[model samples]
Target: MINTRPRLAWHRARLLTIGVAVWAAAAALLTPVAASAAVDNPAPTPLVSFTFDDGMQNALTQAAPTLKKYGLTGTSYVNTSCVGMTTVPNTCRASTDVPYMTWDQITQLQNTYGWEIGSHTVNHLCLVSVGDDCQATKLTAAQVDAELANSKATLAAHGFNATAFAPPYGDYDMSVLAQIAKYYSSMRGFADTGNNPWPLGDYLIRNIPVQERTTPVATLKARVDEAITNKTWAVFTFHDIRPSPSQNPDDYQYGTAELDQLAAYVQSKVAAGQIKNVNISKGLVNGSPNLLANPTFNNGIGDGWRTDAPSTITADIGNTGSFPDSARSVKMVSGSAAGHLFSPKVPVTAGTNYLFKSFLNVAAISSGEVGFYVDEYNAAGQWISGQFRKRENTRWVESMNFTYTPSSTSVASASLQVYVTGTGITAYLDNVQMLALAAGSTPPASVNLVTNGAFDAGISSGWTTDSASTIQADGANRGSPANPVNSVKLTATTATRHLFSPQVAVTPGTYKIASYLNITARTSGEMGFYIDEYNAAGQWISGQWKLGVSAAGVTNVDLTYSPSTSSVAKASLQVIVQGNSGLQAYFDDVRWTKS
Candidate 1:
């Protein structure tokens, strides 16, 4: 095993360095008064601080590059005793997880990237009194004193100006706080699902854990959006900056793509001035003015945007069908195959989240795609990462709204690229937007497999069902978020009841069956959906599969089945219900998607 990565070794340091609080709080932990949102202070806008806990080397190799590239900084709380040691010699912590950062790298972050250095206890002691980790038995007061003092001392001795302390494991109490406050300006913790509304007190700084596998990009964006809307600060805690390694990947580890995607969005949002990006100290500041030079496309294309070479495409400042107030937009025509229009470099914050949108009207014959692209770069001015995309409609499509994300942390700038397979195709682009994403609607499902899937025809037109069932198109309670107006309800008592669909055309391939089942009530046996295949001879060729639902409130009915046999002539879908008396079920959005 390559033990080179930092293991957050503090958990193993134990009571060896109980050195008392002699680091002098006034000299080491006094936060600069210049930063916004001091204790109990309010700011005009919300602030979000990006912070990494533990001394992983990836913090430098992986995270710092993006952070520095985006003109952003972060705070990494590390255990001093394990400093520079790939794996600490002795401690309760696992050997594989004890790779602490070298003092050299720590200094590099502070001196080079404006990153804040913070303490996380001498060696991740369980704060004796809180008594959570490191052993069932709590450490003595003397031991706790030694851990805190020695930890801060190590950072101070190594030329690191650490102003905050993150209590290891997010565990702390009034007893721990009283002690920590004497040696630190603030102590960061991971206790809240939401952002912390400041002035954050000296103790209990809240942080959301952006674990790789558990938290999604959409989820992080929502948190940042919440901070922006509520005027609160969002502080984050991370462990391994890189993705889960092939060997012994823990929940604390996430893929670089996830981090990069998040960082790219943060940088974009920061550039837009939609939210304030800060290090640990400045994390509670008022927001800044929008950083965009020509957000509304009012200055004309030449004013700010950088277009492709003139030979391949033609472009001009256009006003036809423009958005309100902004009487102008950029119009482009491809003489050959493809063309691109780009924006000036937009500085971004690393490890952040954002949403983007654009209003466009495309016209004339088209064959290729027209979407946005991001040119990514690192702080050292090296191109690093990016993403490109186009809306589905490029042929005679107009007055359309395009929504997307930069999709990479290294995304340094965005561009509008139009590709037309057909020569002489024209596209109208306007009001390119880089905005925050609010809690949006759930995405619609894919094309369904079964026809008359919803029975919106007011009746089960081509469907076959036992005479006991009926389609309830009336506004009775049979409704789901997906299909609110139509459903086929079945009430069964003793005898089994089934609703089958007419035989549909089939080919040798895989198909997905998805439906929603809502049980008004159930003493359940079972109600399910099924797929059956028959050969050309009109006889069952032994291809059958089923998925069932047993509970209430709209249970998901989804499964994948394949009639791989070329002999398949046709296929039929059915819903069968059986069980005790008085079992009522409503099913809707019955779809069979072919892949």
Candidate 2:
């Protein structure tokens, strides 16, 4: 029975009384972190947004109270067709029982509870799905357009902003979206259950459905637990919630206690600053590359963040407008034991610089040091190292920025976290972001894979070739004539001529196909290299080709490629120097590396 603390610094000072105890040792010992998670899929943050589709009356009566008790809010989708028309009470069939929300009740939830109202459609139209909430008629694009547009217009007309849509039966095509795109900001779709990656398609947000009879309370908690652990985004969909066992209950409907349990868990994590329960519209807003989702804490306590376990730290939202342009910022109060607040993991490119900035306002955080860091992890999902950013607890007047560079290409995700130490720590963080520096920034380290890379061992078993070309030991054109030659010269007379490397085994990382080309002579045609990939079973996956040329001196020609499981583990590298019959080329250190 963990009790949540009040959300503001001032309120906690006067009203602080109770605290909850937890089995911190047992929890940490049992749970192991997993890698292979889709890295920084969305704007970082483990967000779990709740949405109720089909305008059911139970949303207001049974669901709303449970949500409010847990200090939670959600977006509920409605279709204008059955806004108020519900079945008579005391029935026992899907066709005979259950109730639909009236327009008044829907408005009350929006106006009174700060809940978002989204469009389902003018009708619950489905193009393919044959489930509940499906409008079986194969609607035309124009018909779908009208349904989407009219519903959005109606909700707006009634004072609901109605920015996002929840497709009935999770059915929609590009044509349907292109039309709806005219009026809505984003759309919530069923089936796909995970975070909405940036540039956030806005057209199709994924969701997971939950029910009392099917999705147990423990399962619901586990789903959110995974999202929190991975720092990913997820949306949960639900329907009716009745007090007692419903004989003819729809699989989508839930019992009150189940909903209560789920809500209570959300509240606990939110109070601990572990995750965010946001509305779909939050992701659709002016998509940018900055990761750290819900940085402002607008989604309440649970929006994808976490603090220490079994600790006396209390967390909640607070109005920090006194700090200039402040909105809603998270407020955490430290008890005797020092606590930490960890941010969601953000994916980054190795050797690339990432810029991070954040705004902080403190309330009497005297004495102890406030620490900021970049916790880096490898592709295996294990914490490899950490980079310190801010070691001072300096009071911020406005904002601060920090930049860090990862050391290896195998680096997967980097999460931001802050440690508070000292007497009575209380603070708020707002407007934070972590962005990957664009290409043409600091360069990555390169690795050479060509055996006898300098050809010091002479033209040998490493390179396979066609009859059109041959490698000769050259001493004169290697970088300059002065040095003893360890380089090989490739002279190609035909298009099929190439010096190919044996199959190289690779893991997931960036690779460069590079060669030192000193073309003493050039005439017709193009000179290039190609990389062909193969799966574990020796099946061809894909290939890419690029060309380079320089008349005199030496030209360092190179290109990079990243391999995935989709392309398998083996790659064949080929170097082709094609031109006129006397087209001469020099090859020194040809390499492919994880850098």
Candidate 3:
């Protein structure tokens, strides 16, 4: 609702008038000639940075731990005067009381977690008033110098060499930029919503805020995707990380779980080598390196792997090919005890998260289970702990991934293993991978599994109607404005008839099914959506029928369905209508997405 256009335009104008020379000089010193390519030119590698403002205490207690779980570190911009304050400081625009991180805590963030410490002025003063309080533009040039120079000095006194700056409230003008350039290498702006180009505008570095309530995890992932596609740097700003965030947007609070989810998503991208997560000081870098050697077993199992139980576990470099890549796979057979295939010992940092993944094929498992685990060791090579990550008790073929953070700081190394624990279990494992996560990682985004859900190509594209009903695409009545030019209209006889969508392949997870329907006419019965489940063998097993509605107007049909059994490997969305001869309805914009 707030118009920030005039302020942004003015900011740009001032940058050209007063900050251009400073920015050009800094760019020449920092960026290479090759880095000044066209904005459309893709970056060699996409970069992302997690940055926090105002040095909130939760940035240490909550945000740091969450980011560490994904093996990530962020930049924390601290207001020197606000450090250790239990009440809202007069320099801060915020009205509510919130604790700020202490000097010791900030040091730990830098020394222990490898986070970058940045300046946020001596007092949280807005350089120029846009609309909020704490405006300091009225103050003399000497005061502004103290705000900038003094804050950097304080950080230096505390043994932190701060190099980045973020203007409070993103309120700044030409004078502010000139002063900021004197104190820091880069300055981040609050309202700049898009990713930064290869040769960044260091003086006004753009960032997207991770606000609670308004900003969803999906939106953040999209930003990451955009950066990867455009080959740019994506910086996200955060404030308080709380277990229960206030609904007020002014609080600038986000839930801890949401942060974890975003972190997981970013970690997944890092694992896939789509983007590199870095701090503000580190412009761009390579992504997380794959720790496990010979992940595909292409060079032979002896390269970096050994069988713990040689009698039951064998390296099958022939015949059995690896998943995703045509290489080699290892096999394990259950014996009296578990058989283990251990990867080479990988050095691990304490309190940092790691992701282990492998594709597995269970040919047969009559009684027991096959598990993916990690065995931890201390610096002295003594066994510290063994963690059971994930397992499969049934016959299935899929990729299994699990994240693990060393429980004890003493843990120095880990060996990933695939073991068969049950009797008569035979499984093939391939394409094993282990990568350290950046701090604050989350799971990957899910996709819509429904085929031709919008009926764009016509009813026969991916739908089948029972003999008792006739289905046709209706362009005139598309059910909703968001829908495409066509919606499938089903007219059924006195008998109940069903129009079914193409069978969608699925894994073991929750799915959301939604569709818009318009019941133009109906005489006796109701109409709604149903999800029919199928086993791995493509045999119909069961179904979940939603409560049918008989209203003769546009209605939304939504349902959340999870597999009732592990065998459910496929599902189909069924639009069922039962009534008299005149039963007619329209269905459009059907969607089936993993939740």
* Each candidate structure's count of clashing pairs: 20, 14, 17
Model 1 residue 168 lDDT score? 71
TM-score for each of the candidates: 0.40, 0.47, 0.42
**Between 1 and 3, whose lDDT is larger?**
3
Q: Pick the candidate with the highest TM-score.
A: 2
TM-score of 3: 0.42
Specify the highest-lDDT model's number: 3
Across 1-595, the per-residue lDDT of candidate 3 in tens digits comes to 1111111000000000000011111111111112122222122358899999999888899999999999989999999888877656534443246788789999999888889999988878767663446652475777777888899899999998888888888877655565565456567889767888753555667899988879989999999999889778899999888999988887889999999999999999999988889898686221234677777777666655776588778767553543235346777888875566767777776645566666666768776567666777677666665554556767765446566666577877777767676567887777676666543342322244777666767676667776523777777734432233577788877666677778888888877776656677867667756677788887888776656777675554457778878888887877666647477877776667786
Which ranges of candidate 2 are over 4 A from the true structure? 1-43, 86-96, 128-136, 195-199, 245-250, 285-595
Error of 2 at 403 (Å): 16
What tens digits encode model 1's per-residue C-alpha lDDT throughout 445-533? 13444676656654456676664444234345353331245566777766666676666667777776655466776775666555656
Which candidate would rank higher by TM-score, 2 or 3?
A: 2
Q: Give the Cα-based TM-score of candidate 1 against the true structure.
A: 0.40
Ranking, lDDT, top scorer first:
3, 2, 1
